[model samples]
Target: MSAKITLIAMQVCGVLFISNSAFGQATPQDASVNQGTSASQDAELEVLTVEGRALSLYQGNGAVFATRTNSDIDKIPQTVQIITQELIEDQAAYEISDLFRSMSGVSYLNYGIVKMRGFEQESQVFYDGIKGDPFRTFTIPQLFNIEQVQTLKGPSGAAYGAGEAGGAINYVTKKPTFEQENTAELRLGNKGFFSGSIESSGPVNEDSSQRYRVGVYSSTEDSYRNNVEEDNLILDLGYAWDFSNDSTLTVQYTHFDQLGERLRGVPIDENGNFLTDISWNSNEPDDEQDFQSDIFQVNLEHSFNDWLSSNSTVRYYDTEEVIKFHQARALVDNDDDGVYDEITRRYQDQTRIYQGIDLASYLVADLGEHTVVAGADYHFASEDEVFYYANGVNNGVSNLSLTNPSYDSDISAYNATLNRDRLTELDQIGVYIQDQWQATAKLNVLAGARLDYFSEDYIDNEDNADNTSYNDLGYSVRLGATYDLNAQIKPYTSFSTGLTPQTASDQEDSLDGELFDPEEAQQFEVGVRSYLLDNILNLNAAIYHIDRKNTISADEDGNTSAIGKVRSQGFEVDALMDITPRWVASINYTYTDVEADDISEDNTVYRILANNPYHQVGVWTRYEFPAISSSIAFGAEYVGERTDRTTSYDAPFTIQPYTIYDLSWQTAVQDWKLQLNIKNLFDKEFALAGFNEVSGAIVGERRRIYLQASYDF
Candidate 1:
């Protein structure tokens, strides 16, 4: 059934392309109806022109992913997706998960994890080209001050060292512009959600050489699950200065504070079915989670001449978190009723702190037909965590009944026990050089290589154990070429390699206690991109195969080894078009297949990779009625079935597929604009991800509605 629907959608897109192409070539005509009019009192027709700006949703002018420099997307020779501010506002996206619904081959998982190209992408988020924490707990970053989001799919090790196989996501924040602009907004929604925000930017000096900008956001909301609520506040400020010698410097700072209730996974029955009657939150009403972060960055660019330019950047980041909750331990048949009767509970307290610094410098040189870039970077990061756990029959926390659950239990009898106190430190340095050669008018070549040195140290204070340290040096490379068939079409292919160093703890329980090697991945990709109907429609398709080695796998005896391998191959297609002056549409489809190789005879790796769908689709369209100053949009998304194991060595279980729909409307009157958004129009219920039987599964969100009003001056 899915195959048939995909075929029909492809045919319809083809028809629309042809019809729109023909319509674009038609000529306009004007008729002279009133030829006889008195000279003294001539009837006049008012000629009012209603000019419209060209749409930016389908346009990809410049990007900085493939290389550190801003270049045209078609010349990058990779799969890059850009989510513009216009699209974010049109979709009314508030968080990173909300933005993922419009993208292809990307899905949200538990605890800040996202699956991209059949691989888990964790801790690969960057802010203004600097890497941030990968394990952000409880809440994702809000979109109140972000300008754009860029995703580069597949291995990008040649440019950015020590990354995952799934690629990287960069968040570009709003910068200071020398223009007078201010906006104020208020939003209200279901589930007792409300928010207010303001943004202001302008010049600070008479010559406009100095500029400043500020943004503030505050919100309070309740979740669909019982005993779940959130309160958050965010602030962003920026300053920029342009010197008389053509040099520029910019500084930025951001602070975030949040307090919310944590929601654990839902329980499952003996047959691997979700317990529909149970609430998503498994803890008491008094449970709490807190997060705070502060980030500072500075960037400077100087030009000595037309042929020589240099750029430098430095960043400092700090974060702290505290969590207190009740965790589910096990499911047992205490009553002997043939079904799960009770759930054991455990009390936990955890505190974590993280600090990091990053510095990089780049030099760009031009020589005839070749343009080269040389850069180097250094990173230092440290983490400290303290954890306490309490588990006993007489503890304050009470066991929960599978059928009748209550959250009013007190924990006065619980005694906190110190279990873990650990400190981890890491340092890395990398250097690389890239060359872009315009060999001919229609052909281009790109090549680059990077060498990186990494070291890590771990200390366990509670046990007074010996300090463990690991160090390694890794190298990555990339080579690609692109050929233009015509002014409207380009075909390109690339090969790249990636590397990630292993930590000391990864060898703690190994059979031989030997330090493991770093994980490595290699990829080969080919794709074609086209611009039709005078650059109004953009179409792209690509196919790629990737092989990852040195994956950590464990045996039945609880001993670990890095002797596993997996291969992923997939194909993707994306289309963005302006059907008419008042209509726009986008469609994307992805097909992924992942398989494990029998590298070690003693290891079982069949069901280690889960929660990745084989087929995914997303489609959206919007129309504008200029006469009424209003616009409307509608979209739908589909996810295919997935398979997972009940335990490490157990047989696989299949999870069913599901689809969701969304709608939005917006209108403007003078300086005020009103918008409404409806998500999960059908209120569908499904599982987002799952692990072992005892670990249960994460449930998807239900229906939600939001209304917003804004004024600009």
Candidate 2:
């Protein structure tokens, strides 16, 4: 059934493109009507002004401001997806993961940074044009006070350093506008859930020269299935001081603390077949565990002069997790009387810190019509990972030896076991130059490259002799060109490069010389972005061919093995349409063509486990009623089924495409404001996991509702 749907989807998409192409030739006859329809649709956000400025907050509400506008989005050469704040509010999505229901070609690999993508790790994430956090952290975002989110496809390495080809995701935080902003919400639903938040930001002075913003959120809940609950809290504080001059200083800090259940993959039998009614018990009965992850960061940017500028940041992360499952599932009998054996227990804790300085200067040199930039950056990060495992009758694999199925108010009974500590440090220094020059009024040439030197070291506390260090040098390059086929449409092409390390494991004998060469991943991209219907609507489409090789895999002998490579090529189309005074819509689609260059084992390798799907799509739209001062938005997402070619056992695992319908209403009653949001309107059961890996399993969210009211002085 899934296969049938996949084929039909592919055919329809092809037909739509061909049919649209044909319509292109009949433009003269439909030109008048097209202009009218386009205008009517565009009226939705064009006339709308935020306190009287021709700005679009909802159109790209969730996108990075610098890259969300029609002028910039249409001028760029890549595909992008925008999830506006309004849309977020409408969905009442409390976390970034909730967005999977309305996104395409992207899925959480393991509820973390291991998301499936056409790019490698080390990809960058941004919040208001500044780095957010390390990609490996897989930090989930809080939505009580976000403005916009932008997902840019292809390598953004040109603007962001130490990036992977997976493109980038930039989140724009809610800013303290010149005018007052106010909102409040409370959510209560099934599974003993309760959540609440309040936020306000505006001018501290009558002149609107100084502003302040604060947001706080907290949630407590027990989930569907056994031993699952969520306890999370978030805080955001910000201030902006705009001096009389053209200088501004904005200070913001975000802190989040969460204690939630660890993710669990679906269970499989001895034959490698998934269990029929796998325990709805989200709890790992054998593992009776809990997790806590906390993060905090500060950002500062001072525009001293137009010719020179500096940006700096400080960040810290701490995580603690405990696992109590038995490594061996089979039972054993020490005596002749057959008896069962229990699983052991394990726990892990980690702390990481990062401090960095990035300073860039835009040179005012007479180099024709060229925008030249030169800069240097230095950063250092250190991490300590601690692990422990225990064995005792009190800590067995089964419920008998572990906590009972029922809830436990206190968690003081467990004891610590074998303990191990590992420390790792990374230091990097880089310099780069970039130039964006217009060859002609109709064409632009862009070029940029960076040379980065990185050092890494690992130390084991007990075994001093096992400690090791390594270093490597890698260069990232980007080249592209854009042609203006008039101001309404432009076509562009680009090529970018990135580095993937040869190995992720600790180097033993040769940590310095032999294990330090950085492998390369390359990408070729071509796209056309356009502004049609009077520059109010946006249409972007692109095609890309990406390849990765020289990846280090493990051999049967557990030695370094540079085996096969992976490849994916696809075409995509994304659009944002402002059709009416109160209606807007967006869509993203990708059809990837993938193949393996080689594999350790032909049959077992390059299998369905590759997870490079053939097709993916997303669509979201919203409509607001200005008369009633209320608005509504709905979104849809689809992901094709996957096959496990290796086992041929659930060879065809069908994860039916699920749709989540959401609606939000916002209006003002004098000083009072009200909002209502609904998520997973259909209450569908599904998974957003990316592949056949053990981590590719999740119990999707169910129907949820939220409501709130607020008043300001």
Top candidate on lDDT is 1
Error of 1 at 339 (Å): 2.7
The CA lDDT at 357 in model 1 is 90
Tens-digit per-residue lDDT, 92-186, candidate 1:
88877777766766866565667788787875677777776523755577788888888888888888888888778888889987676666677
Candidate 1: stretches off by over 4 Å: 1-55, 134-138, 269-272, 392-394, 510-513, 533-536, 556-559, 599-608, 644-648
lDDT of each: 0.76, 0.55
> Which candidate comes out best when scored by TM-score?
1
